[model samples]
Target: MKALLLAGGLGTRLRPLTENLPKPMALVGNKPWLEHLIVHLKQQGIGDFVLAVKHYADVIKKRLGDGSSLGVRIEYAIEEDLLGTAGAIKNAEDLLSDRFLVVNSDIIHEISIIPLLEFHRNHNGLVTIGLTEVEDPSQYGVVELDMSGRILRFVEKPNKHEAPSRFINAGIYVMEKEALQWIPKHKEVSIERETFPLLIEKNIGVYGKTINGYWMDMGTKNRYRQLHWDLLDGKFTLPLKEKEQGKGIWLGRNTEIGPGVLLVPPVLIGDEVHIGERSVIGPYAVIGDHCELGRHVRCSETIMWDKCKVHDSTQLNNCIFGYGLEVGSRHILHEAVMNRAVGVIQG
Candidate 1:
């Protein structure tokens, strides 16, 4: 079945990281964010994909380019203007199959689609929303269901005391083409706010299937950092075979380590990285491709993107670095996230 990936959302909460980058293009582990999501979905037998993109659409197009590199067939539904959730689906109407799957842009999960498909097929509901339990129901629209699994009502970010159930929208949905009737044309429509509620009010069948798996939404800076930490701690597994190179370190090709360098476990040094002598890296440091570090540099719990250079005696902890940044000698930073180039620094 065809899966529609919502890759166009403007990541307002994840600033700097998403300043020049699309939310879907944010780096997760060593691969592009969307790449990681697609690889996992592809492994679960998703045949084809439709990326509905608006913001930074070209960047996504340039990187994914027909999905051939990822071994899946991909088509783009480029929106000229901002189309909200249901509108995005409406814009891609021609590309969608009779039965399709819709996943939110921020969602990343390991949940299997087989059971959800089976549940959708067996039930009489025209729409099936995959539901997952979350500790904070206040952050997401809560799904309430009848005993038969038919959805009764949806509460939009209800208070914890007033919440009927802890199960919230996992942002994965199974829908029939007929459901498109509720979504009007040439307008900004939210699937969560508009379509599903109308379906329930019309006595149309809308069901919820409780799914279990590792799931997280990268919506903010804190969550993004937590995602990396979780991955490093083995809470979730990356799809690539090269993820676990040796002793919890994921090393890229042609990486050079200077003598007396200490690499702790759970470190990822990308391709062509050069480190000077006596530098201590990791126990959760993620150095992207072509990064250079001078002698006596200490970095732990840090993630630096490609081409970043750390000068001699610099120290970093809990920092996130963007592309092509250069730091002068003897600088120390903690809990910082950046995207622009760095200038001179002193102790």
Candidate 2:
């Protein structure tokens, strides 16, 4: 099957991180977030992919490189202007199949597509939206469904008291080519606000399938950090395989731990990492590839990107260090987000 990956968003909310890289390229488990999505879709029998990209389009193109190595045929639809969700898909109408899957690039979900496809085919709907129950529907596009699983109403970010249901749009949809007609040409059209609502108004078949699995929209820094914590806690599993050095510590290739270094469980240290003597790491720490940690350093609940250097006597908690960052000696960083261009130091 063919799938459309909407990866063009600027990710304004995830600033500093998204400032240098596109939202789809955000790091999750040491891999680009979009890579995880691709792998997940591939597992669900998707062999062809069309990436609709605008921001950092070249970076995405270069990294993915025709997708041949990943065993999929990948194509790109570069948008010249800002096209919203449905508009982007309309921009790639020539590349889409008669029926295709549409997925938002920033979502982290594990819903079974097999069942969703089954539901969509059985209902013969023009579009089928994947819905998941969220604790706060006010932050999402809420959907109300009838007894037959047909969509009855759509509410974008409704107030808590006004929300009719907790099930919100999960950003995954099975769409038929006929649905494209509802979207106009060369304009920013939101599927949630325009297409789906228009279909409902016309009494067209629009269905919602409430999925039972892990689902999250990693659009903010807090949720991004929480994703890593959840991974280490075994809440979800990625496709990558690393050697388990201890009970809950996963080590990559050639990782070196010095004498007297304390490694708590549930830690992930990437390849060629060097940990100095008397240093303590983890309980939810993810040190990326080729990182250098100095003696007497303490790191917990932190994510250090590739090639980061931490000096001696440094302590980090609830922090995120971007690639190649250097921490000076005796520095104590807590609740911080540091990168080459920006730094957020909170107590």
Candidate 3:
């Protein structure tokens, strides 16, 4: 089945990280955020991908290529203008056949789509959305479903007092071809704001499937940091192979751990990462690909993205460093999320 990846958003909330790259291209683990979503969908038998691109469209296409490397056929729906979610999908209607999946590339989730699709097919629903319980439903589009899973209402970011239910839209959906008919072509429209409510009003079979899985919206620095911590803690499963006989360590391909380093378990070190001698890492740390960790550095619950360099005596705790950042020797960074470039400091 084809999947529509909504990758066109400006990602204003992600800030400096999004300033240079699109949110989908942000490093979440070792690869770009979009890569994980694509891989996950591919594993679920949804291979053909249509990425709706806007900001940095060329970059996304350059990085992902034809998706053949991941065993999927990839296509692009370049949005010349900023289109809303419904508009983006409507633009790609010609490419979509049968029941297809829709997802936001910015969110991180491990939703099992098979059951969701099954429910949609069995009920012959116009749309089936993936819903999950959240502590704060007010922050998301609150969904109310009947006993039979038919959506009673779609409340967009309701206040706590006005919330119909705790189940919120997971930004993942299985859409029947008929649902696209509601969306007008070349117009800015949101599925939540326009199409979903319209479907409910028309008594169309717009329903939801509640899923209990590891799900996170990495829209902020705090959420992004927590995602990496969860990954290191083995809270979620990936398709990649695990490291043998290592406690709390998920080493990706070609990673090198230096000697005399005190590594506490639950640390995820990605491919080609170099942890220098006498460095103390973890108790919830995530080191991304090609990182250069200098000697005698102490890090606790820190996340360093790809190609970052942390020099000697730099103590990092509860911090998240974006890709290509540099920390000089003898510097101590605590509880910080650094996204911009840093100049070298000579002691």
Candidate 4:
């Protein structure tokens, strides 16, 4: 099956980081967030993919070429203009000839797509949408479904006092080619705002498939940080194993560490990480590739990406340091996020 990935949105909510990256390219752990999505989709027997891109489209294409490495064939539909989700799919109308899956690129989750596909085939619906229960439906496009899983209504973000259900759209869907007929070409259109409501009004075959797994929208800095913590805590099922709790720490290949260092559990030091003597590392720190930690440094619940240097006596707590950052001697970073491209130092 072919899948349509909407990767064009400018990640305005995730500022600093998004200042240099599209949402899909944001790093979750050691790799781009989209890498997890691509790998997950490949494992589910969906080999052919089409990406609808606009903002920084070239960068995304350059990073993941042809999907050959991931064992999938990738084609791109670049939008010179900003098109809404439904409109972007309509733009790639020719590529989708049969039943297909569509997903927003910003979503991070276990990506267990087989059950949704099975649900689609079983019901033979024109469209089967993934829904997750949320605490507040007022902030989301809510879905009201019948006992048979048929969608009874698609409500826009309703006021808290008037919401019909707590199940919100998960931004993933299995759609048939027939649904494409409802989308207009080259116009701003949202699946939630325009298409789904019209489909329900016309009694089209719309169903909801509830997913039971880890799902998160990493669209903010806080959520981004939380995602790494969750992964380190084994919130998802993947090949990458979290280092055992209370195991002190596990440094990746070729790492160098000095004597008299105090290492803590739940810490991951990526390949070639350098640590100086007497440094105190965290129970929740993630040090990426080629990082250097100078003597007497203390870090806890922190994330330092590639090539970052934390000098002597510096302290970092609940902080995220972007790639290629150089911390001065005795500098303290706490609850701050630095963008790699911005070059702004945070204290």
Candidate 5:
């Protein structure tokens, strides 16, 4: 099966991080976020991929390159201007198979695609949207479905009082090639707002299948950090090249641990990491590759990207450090996020 990954968003919500890298390329568990999704899809037996790219498209191309290393055949669909979800898929119509899976690259979830495909095929629908129940329906595009599982209405970000259901569109879909015909060419269109509603009005088959599993949209900094915490806490397992040093603790090759250093469980330390004496790290911490940590430093619930250097006597809690950052001595950083360009430390 072929999959169309919508990865073109500018990631405005994840500012400093996205400023340097695309959302899909954002580091999660010391690997690109998109890599996890691709690996998941590949495990499910999907091979060919069409990546709809816009923001920092070249960087993604360079990083993923022909997808050979990933064991998938990848094709790029570059959009010159901002194209909404359906519009982006329409732009890549030429690369799409007769029936394909469309997934939003920003989301991390455990839902299986096999059942979704079966549901789509059984219903013979033009488009079948994956729906999941959320506590707050106001933040998502809620879907109202008939008893037969056919979509009756689409409400985009409804108010709490106005919401008709708790089930929201999960940003995953199975679509037949004919579904692309509904999307107009050379135009910005939203599948939720325009295409799906138009199909419903025209009496075309647009179905909704409720899926049960862990699902999160890693579009915000807090959620991004939480994803790491979840991984370490065993909410889900991600494939890592590093060896498991202990329960909930993974260490890469040549990682050094100094005398009197305390490594709490649920920590991931990357390659060539050096932890100084008497330093306490993690209950949930992700130390990226080539990081140098000084003595008496304390880090908890933090994510430090590659090549970061933390000076002695620094304390970081609930912090995120981007690539190549250098911290001054005696700094106590709590609930902070720092990146390269905007050096202004945020809490």
Candidate 6:
């Protein structure tokens, strides 16, 4: 099946990180999170891809040129302006097959599409949305389904007491090409807010398929942090695994650890990393490629991007550092996020 991935959100909430990256371009486990999604979809017998991109489309184009490297054929539908979810799919109308999959790029999941496809085909629905049960349906658009799996109604962010169901829209959809007719072109339109409701009002063949697997919306900073922590903690496995120096400790090539340096497990240190004597790292530390840590440094729950330098006696916890930071001596940071693109020593 050809899939149209909504890859164009501004990622406004991910401020510093999205300051330089599209939401899909955010790094998780030292690789683009979007790459993981592509690999997942490709594994499910869906090879042809259409990335409907708007924000930072150039960056995506440069990094994942033609998708040939991943053994999948990819095409990009670049939107000149920010198109809402449904509008984005409408924008890529010509690229979709008679039956297509539409997925939001900001989510990660462990669902298998085979069953969803079977349900969609059997029901002959205009759209079959994947549903996942959530504890707090109060924050999401909850779905109510009949015994036949036909969508009954949607409650947008209903209070817990008023909520009719725990299953919420999982941002994954299988749609017939004709469903595009329901959406208008050349303007912002929300699939959830407008089109889906219209189809329901018309009593169209709109269905919901419940998915029981790992699912997460990696749209916020905290969620991004959670993704890394979960992966390191063995919650769910990703397609790419880093080279391990020890159990739970992944070390890239040419990474050097000094004498008396203490490394806790579950740390990811990238290539060409140098750790000085007496430094303590890990228990969720991610040191990117070409990074250097000086003597007496202590870091935990930190993610430092490529070419970062932490000087002697520096301590960091729950911090995220973007490219090329040179932290000075004896500094301590907690819950800090730095987005410095230039290489500069900090004092």
**Overall lDDT per candidate, in order of appearance:** 0.86, 0.88, 0.83, 0.84, 0.90, 0.87
State TM-scores per candidate: 0.95, 0.96, 0.92, 0.93, 0.97, 0.95
Top-scoring candidate (lDDT): 5
lDDT (Cα, tens digit) per residue for candidate 6, span 225-300: 8888888887887765558777898888888999999999889888899999999998899888889999999999
How far out, in Å, is residue 103 in model 4?
Answer: 1.4
Candidate 4 per-residue C-alpha lDDT over 135-174 given as tens digits, one digit per residue, 9 for 90 to 100: 8889889888899899999788899778888898898999
Positional deviation of residue 310's Cα in model 6 after best superposition, in angstroms: 1.8
Please give, for residues 1-347, the per-residue lDDT of candidate 3 as tens digits: 89999999988877666776789888776678798889988877887999998999988988889998888999998888877999999988888877788998898987788888888888867898888898878878898888999998878789988898999888888898888878888889988878899999999889899876889988987888788777766687655443634766678778777899987887777778888899998888888888898999899988778889889888988887777898889999877767756432211
Model 2's alpha-carbon lDDT is 0.88
lDDT of 5 by residue, 79-156 (tens): 999889989999999999999999999998877888999999898679899999988899888888999899999888
The alpha-carbon lDDT assigned to residue 47 of candidate 1 equals 61
TM-score of model 6 relative to the true fold? Answer: 0.95
Model 1: weakest 10-residue lDDT segment is: 338-347
> Clashing residue pairs, candidate 4?
none
On lDDT, who's better, 2 or 5? Answer: 5
Clashing pairs in 1: none
Listing every candidate in turn, what is its Cα RMSD in Å to the true structure after a full C-alpha superposition?
A: 2.3, 1.4, 2.9, 2.1, 1.3, 2.3
lDDT of 2 by residue, 208-229 (tens): 9988788878887899899888
Model 4 misplaced stretches (Cα beyond 4 Å): 159-162, 241-248, 345-347
The collision pairs in model 3 are 248-266
